[model samples]
Target: MDAWVSHAGIFSATIKFNEPLQVAWVNTSGDQVTPGSFSLDPLKVKSKRAYINQTVPFTIADEAAFSAFTSAMITQPNFTWHLTSDKLDVRALAFPTAHGLHFKKDVTLNGMNNFGRARLARRLQAARDDPAGGIVFSATTGLDNSSAFNVNLGTGSGANTVIKPGSNAVTLDGRLVPQTGTDALATTFELFTKYLNGEQADVVATGKSSIQADGRAVSWLSAGLTALELHVPFVAPGGAVSPIKAITIGDMSLEFSTHAPWAPVSNSRTVLAAMELPFGFGLEIEEISNRGRCRACQLDG
Candidate 1:
């Protein structure tokens, strides 16, 4: 016969960011996560029965975890949340409140062939014919019939490229218009082209390529447990050690608070620097497996 054992006590927690080439993990401190601080929110409806299942809440451990959590929030970077107990391990992904666009290379005209190919060819031919004459190329911003940015290549292709918010506008010459700032479609084509070419003009005039979260916001948390391991000790009737069984939780959500750093603050003061805003997140579990083995039986065999 095998006797079961119970594991119930305080556990350790760790949080880590999954970034390219570098991963950061922070341990919880007493100041960050207080004792008996874990909780789940109750779902409520105006005229219906309330659901008691929703988001879980917990405080960060200390100044270090708080600082790290703050950084992750502002940067909108990806991170992993972990909770470890004597017999269980829980984990989840904490999504960012905001994200920005990043362009890896410069935009050029040679790549576009649909709209301006013939007109550009005519301009080049005309320029060659009159050595003293130069091709006139100009661009402006305005709403098209569809209320999108009207991008004219100034060529006689009779084709107009329209740009919408959160979408890229490709010119007749293969230039990529960035989808950044509040009103990117209002930006002049000349400035838009220059900015994509790595020119440092007034970003305000061209529109910002990135923006941070102004206040507390929430984002999606995805795929929960990357790995989970549990250890359960078993005892035999004769007081001898029996097989040890390992159990794992397949799915769970790990939610917590995270602050967006909209303004800069001095890091010298630990308390002031460690403040974090509220946020919630959850991660889905992929799979779960278990196994049991008896050392005493193995030795006897």
Candidate 2:
């Protein structure tokens, strides 16, 4: 097709379960989804514009593993979304007489209308926040149709970064994401393994767009999951698995979740806070303390 989206970094996605779920995905939207592909030339991602929905036997192996996973949720990182595409030359028209109005004039950010990156950045930073200070935005960047979370969670990054963190950094994987084919549940678990092992990320990062936040960008994000079965396949070497250990009283849905940007609080974000299951009833991540163990930029492995 001549009309191809070279920067459609991500597209459609979906997930299926091997068992039942206490939670489920209700997609009556009837969006026709077809198979797709992934490549570098055009940044091809998922094809069908469906969120990856899978039924997983969500489980935790050992305490360390559990800690790692939970840390991913609570750990903080400010992803500086550099949304300047090279297609067009963006520059500022700073008139010496404009009396310091609005950062700069013609500062290359052409109102974020022409490209997906700029648009996503605009929506991501719209909620009383700084343009370059994205705490945990992928989880809240439903900035544009080209965004993954906006495509997947049906209400991704634009949701709640923190169930209610009093900080700019939000959820680990930036919860909101563009649709893709990788099994999110499985991938999330795999990340834990890598974290446990402290291995180098699969894809070496390069260029100005790459921001290293302790591997948090690569390891943290997993689309919400659903299934009836109580089995999950995430096991670190020499580690054993067990059923998810979590309890809740109020609704764990994303509705009551707090919508705010990253800020310094007097206490730990997870202190006396409730972890929202996110989106629909995704795999309810067992709640635990934010021991500052989840290092998102670099992995221990």
Candidate 3:
């Protein structure tokens, strides 16, 4: 039972694939950036098994198809990946034949837990029960990404994450991104070279982010919480029951890792910006380089 997941609340689903799949692509090999060796022809894909909500084995019956899929991943310099689009060539996805099942019966979580708390007992029993064919969780989500990165330095210990007292954590977080520089950013392989040579990668984002969002139609939402911040209901008061119709946060990018012994950025004497609201216009105020909001909520007035 293979599963797929994302930054979404956990849920269980049972799906029945009542049809076969079809897919097509163009493949270009060798040193020359020429036409695809494989034509863009839709090929049929047969399901060996379609047991939803379970960890089932799915195989690509066609040998070349399987190889093409596997070769799709050209990983970055480190064990990292950027949620950027310019990465994959859609030309390879010339066309696709989906075995899209009747999505009606699928168990969706929107109506789920709206009442709160999945009983602990049922959760435990679900874990212990047999006939509980393992589960495969996958969801289709339209994605629009600007920039993202995954940096794994091959060092995995609580100590690697330890930010020396008073020292900035971003200076040590085993990763870096350049806001401005002439040198081409290092690749995953090149990043590894730096790690071996004790070189530095710009990891720290120096200033607080600026944002303006229409909560009603926000295209993206990302946030973080350092040791200094906590999860709280952050909403604007539009007259007692304010609907923060929109929101924005420190810049738009979010750092995947936070919480270390870094300096308290909020404590910095440097005043970045100062703005005052004329009383009842509700909103949130935060410090730079520190954890702010991590989750967005849909406020229903």
Every model's TM-score: 0.18, 0.14, 0.16
> Per-residue alpha-carbon lDDT of model 1 for 1-301, expressed as tens digits?
0111122113322222121111123323412221222332212222222223333444444444444443332222223333222212222223332222221211111111111111111111101122333222222222112211122222222243333322232322212233456566556554434433434333211111111133221211101101111111111112222222342334433222235222222222111112221111121348533332222221132
Per-model C-alpha lDDT, please? 0.25, 0.25, 0.24
Best by TM-score: 1
Residue-pair clashes per candidate: 10, 45, 24
What does the lDDT read for residue 197 in candidate 1?
A: 46
lDDT of 3 by residue, 121-207 (tens): 111011121233322111111111111212111222222222121211111111222224334533644533443344543221111
Candidate 1 vs candidate 3: which has greater lDDT? 1
- What lDDT would candidate 3 get against the real structure? 0.24
Candidate 1 lDDT (Cα, whole model)? Answer: 0.25
Error in Å for residue 286 of model 2: 6.0
Weakest 10 consecutive residues of candidate 3 by summed lDDT: 117-126
Candidate ranking (TM-score, best to worst): 1, 3, 2
Indicate the worst ten consecutive residues by lDDT in candidate 1: 221-230
